[model samples]
Target: MRLRNHEGTPVDPVPFLVVVGLTFMFVLSFGPLYGQALGAGLELSVGVSFALFLAVAFGSYYWQVWTARPETVGVVPASVRAVRLFYLMLVLAVLMIGLAIPLML
Candidate 1:
């Protein structure tokens, strides 16, 4: 499907792709994956990992919105908005689980 901003503005495909790419990469590189990789006295708690994930996601969202402006200043389809939120929340939940699993062990 398509992606939209919290403001219900439809995001262009290119910027959306870029945002997803960067967000996923950041999450993979510096989120729980990095923490787990430390594998010693450097283990991070789930709270810290989730917090970092939120920060990275927030920053990525804003940066993308700024980079892909103009048409993003308007409204989008309700279905599109709903889908975007659902997808984002699902991703966040998965990230939390992934982070927590590492710490649980």
Candidate 2:
């Protein structure tokens, strides 16, 4: 389903979904993997990962909402910012996963 802002403008969900998915994966799997690589136990790793995920996800949401506010004016629109954040998150996630894989094996 499509999301709408306060102005009733349709917002693209792709970037949001991508960010969520990548961040989810980072929490559920990548965090633990990285923890293991660092010789940490599963429980501790997962806990830390979950906390980090929440922080990142909430921060992203906050940024999006803040940018979309009527008082906010910028050269870039909220949708464009969302897309840029998505790309940045995607690349970072991929790189982290890539780095984690070697440590895992």
Candidate 3:
């Protein structure tokens, strides 16, 4: 089934799924380090991770809607922006995970 945005345009779920999945993996991998870095406990780290996941999910949805608007049609397609955003997030996640690993040792 297809998802519809605010404009009622059909949205491809792939990009959103990829982003959410990456975010989930990142949280699982980095949540503990996040807590350690901030001097927080397990509970606080889990809470923060949950909040971050929600924020990313909603933020991506809104970003898709904004990019898919008719006014931005001539500039860049929403699909392209979604792909670019996915790669950007992937790079950032890798960097953060890598940085966290050294700290874990």
Candidate 4:
């Protein structure tokens, strides 16, 4: 029921989400578009929000990377696939929380 890459690899959700988040933030960082997107808000406010989002996305993405290590998820003596998944999850979580700080400022 899912799609797999030509190399027989499934799509990595964590990275996929991170990329999307980054793209969104990048677009928002533009001055004219930023103002238009969030009308009536100060420029600094938009910048801060974008910064926070960038932080969260970065943090979580890295967290998942650590957790997804093959050695870390060797609990069931499985292959590297499971390890990758674990790290992916961890990365996503960190990214989500890390993005909040700059936004709050």
Give lDDT tens digits, candidate 2, residues 52-86: 98888777655554235433447678999899879
lDDT per model vs. reference: 0.63, 0.73, 0.75, 0.55
Clashing pairs in 2: none
Model 3 C-alpha lDDT per residue in residues 1-105, reported as the tens digit of each score: 577777687777777778788788777667766776779988888888888888998888777643455454559778998998899979897888686777767
All candidates: TM-score: 0.41, 0.59, 0.66, 0.33
By lDDT, is 1 or 2 better? 2
Model 2 scores a C-alpha lDDT of: 0.73
Off by over 4 Å in 3: 65-97
By TM-score, the better pick of 3 and 4 is 3
Deviation from native of the Cα of residue 41 in model 4, angstroms? 4.4
lDDT of 4 by residue, 64-85 (tens): 4433343333466566677977
What TM-score would candidate 4 get against the native? 0.33
TM-score comparison, 2 vs 3, better candidate: 3
* lDDT, candidate 1, at 45: 38
lDDT of 3 at 49: 84
